[model samples]
Target: MEIVSFEQLDSTQNYLIEALEKSQLQAPLAVIASEQTGGIGSRENLWHSSRGDLLFSFALPLSWLPDDLPLGSSSIYFAYIMKETLIEFQSSIWLKWPNDIYYCENKIGGVVTKMIGKNLVCGMGVNLKKNQKGFEALSIGVEPTFVCKMYLNGLDKKPTWKHIFRKYKLEFDYHKNISTHIMGQKISLHNAVLCDDGSLLINKKRIYSLR
Candidate 1:
């Protein structure tokens, strides 16, 4: 994958998406910034971050995705892999159901996805440095660039969906105490059932992480 790094940017996702749309860049490419001024979040929200946050967006061909992977669960798939990457550094960060990144009870960062033509673009914002208030930072020390490179290196191996799902299920229990938003309403995950395709069955209503 080709990676382009910047000292600062408004939003990596926006820049990458526009590049792809204008034929300036292609899939399997990544854009990173040392500081993101205007990051995006799920539901058209803004992902505010400080100087040392891990801000990046990468695009991959849809055909390169695992055959058994469900489109709606792309956010979880991407987020879990990143959570696994952080664990390699001895960090205690865990992925909340769907896409949020958490440390114990506080959130440290999040992942969001978007479809651009035949490619899938995933944007991740992680707090590796303690520069933001209210939100907690990562538990371990790591150079943001190193973590980004290592993550893409691991992704190049292309683990199967079944493999990631098996591991993610083991940690699904951590979400029972939390709640998630669905159609503008917050719903508890305590009774949410993790389906084979990664959707949750809450009160008989199926919910997906289609960020």
Candidate 2:
């Protein structure tokens, strides 16, 4: 994985997209920054990433993806990978349905995936050193580079969809458990299902579908 780090940027997402478009990089390029002035979030919301947060973006070629996997599943897969990595820090991370990452009821991070030409660009934001207002922070005692390294290590392995799904199932259980304990919500994990098209289902109801 190649990482391009910046001290400050208007938006890491924009920088990544522009870089990829300009350089015409083949695929799998990572863009990380210490601070992003105009960060983006899911559903067209503004992502308020403070200076201490971990913000990054990467581009992946669609040709490398598995034929059986749906395009929308990238976010879910990335979220699970991140949750697994955060567990190493003893941080109990939870997936709020599709892509939001919660520490304990409060959103600590999120993943966003966008399509640029024929490539998929994924952007991730995590509260590491500092937390935004109304958001919680997890002191993982690790730098963004280290986290990125760990993420790349796992991603480079190119685990099968079944392997990724197994990991997702485990995190989904953890998510339900944390929701029950922290939010007093009794959501059944059995109700949770991954649809054939990669949408997330709860109680057989479609909750979130990726782009």
Which is the leading candidate under lDDT?
1
Q: Which of the numbered candidates is closest to the native, going by highest TM-score?
A: 1
Expressed as tens digits, the lDDT of each residue in 61-164 for candidate 2 is 88866665567678877777787778788556777656788887778888888898888888898888655465677876688778877887877777766677
lDDT of each: 0.87, 0.74
Q: Across residues 16-64, which tens digit of lDDT does each residue of candidate 1 receive?
A: 9999999999898999999888899867788878877789999999999
Stretches of model 2 off by over 4 angstroms after superposition: 131-134, 173-192, 201-208
What TM-score, over all chains together, does every model reach?
0.95, 0.83
Which pairs clash (backbone N, Cα, C closer than 3 Å) in model 1?
none
Which 10-residue span in candidate 1 carries the lowest summed lDDT?
131-140
User: Candidate 1: TM-score?
Assistant: 0.95
Distance (Å) between predicted and true CA of 70, model 1? 0.6
Please estimate how well model 1 matches the true structure, expressed as its whole-model Cα lDDT.
0.87
